[model samples]
Target: MAKKQGLNKKLILLDLVFYAILPYIVWNYGKEPFGDYATMLISTIPGFIYTCYRFILEKQFNIAGLFIIGSLALGTMVNLLSGSAEQMIWNGVYLGLFYIVIYFIALIVKRPFSLYFAVDFAYLQGYARKDSATLFFQKGIFNWFQLIQVVFIVRGLFMAGLTVFLLNKYGIDGYGGMLLYKQIAGWFFWMLITGMFIYINIPVQRFLAGQQDKLQDKKTPLSTDEIF
Candidate 1:
């Protein structure tokens, strides 16, 4: 089995720095020299470069990686095409809305993306994809996976509303504030969802462990076999 590459704390720290802190700093300080639209564009550079670097470093060619890169590229295109600071922000809001719709559609079809995300993680941890999928779909487990998808939808809606509220209230000058508040809000929801997942995953772990034990018992030969 391949060694599992668990979460990297350093990469996460860098992500927070590049995505949240650096952008906020650039928007605030670079605004005077670069102006609104230009600064907005400049602020994205660090996060963009960091995301690409991470993608390449991790060699993330999976669906998750593709989604990240695709979103980044789309966001860059939005920034370039946007005429003004407000338009750029609004475009992001629209993009977020589009994602929310996709999630909703996935849920309606009963093929929640959260399930696939888990399967991908399991595969990384040296589990067979087919077995993981089968286990995940087991009666008590599948519903929780759907709940995870709902959580994603809720987070998306919260963010979209928050962004619209901030943009309307703060205008272009409030970009820095938006970045700060969004990061705070994003982290809050992320932690909330993560906790829920941990709580749910405990049972899943037990179930999987029990399954493994059963498999081992089946594999072990009976003492009577030696007599035969």
Candidate 2:
């Protein structure tokens, strides 16, 4: 739990640095050649590289690597074709669509999309009961992850649509104005949705945790090797 919280904190800090501080710097200093676009790209590069590094560390090459490639390709294409900040908004839409597709794929495969979270939860449930943990992984964790993915996809799509609508309604010509509006609206929307998700899930999480505890109490203790 502490480790997970630590990871979450790190992610939060990264987001603050990337989305808030870096965007501000770019908007102010980088208006000429590439405008805010250059700044936005530069700011996001660090996080993108970090994510790739993290994925490498975890030995999960497929999804993260593909995502990075796709993003770079899309970003480049958007920049080259439109040369407008508004085009970059498609990245969000692409991601949302990608996740939605993955969600459906998971359903088709009878696998839960949230395998990572379930694996972590299994570890948290205890390390001494490998078989039970594995069972939970196969049966339950994926479903929960799929549900979360659905939630994320739905929210992301809405945000993407809203972003497009706002960008079109308020042209990107008013550079600073559009940037401010996007920053404020994006932040507020994410915060609101995240808060609601947390608020709604707390009780559900507790309930699940309690159930896991009861199940764990009945399982026989085993060695790490045996469990694993």
For each predicted model, how many residue pairs clash, with residues at least 3 apart or on different chains? 0, 1
Using lDDT as the measure, which candidate wins?
Answer: 1
**Candidate 2 Cα RMSD (Å):** 8.3
Which residue ranges in model 2 land beyond 4 Å of their true spot? 1-11, 36-39, 49-84, 120-133, 137-143, 173-228
Which candidate has the top score in TM-score?
Answer: 1
| Predicted candidate 2 versus true structure: per-residue lDDT over 1-228, tens digit per residue | 999889867866766665566655665566666665665555456455665666566554334345555666665565455444556555555655776677667656756434443344345556434553454454334455455556555655666676677667765544445445555666666666455435534545665788899999999789899978
lDDT (CA) per prediction: 0.84, 0.57
What's the distance in Å from true for residue 209, model 1? 5.3
Judged by whole-model lDDT over C-alpha atoms, candidate 1 comes out at 0.84
In candidate 1, which residue pairs clash?
Answer: none
RMSD of candidates 1 onward, in order: 4.0, 8.3
Cα-lDDT of candidate 2: 0.57
| Colliding pairs, model 2 | 112-142
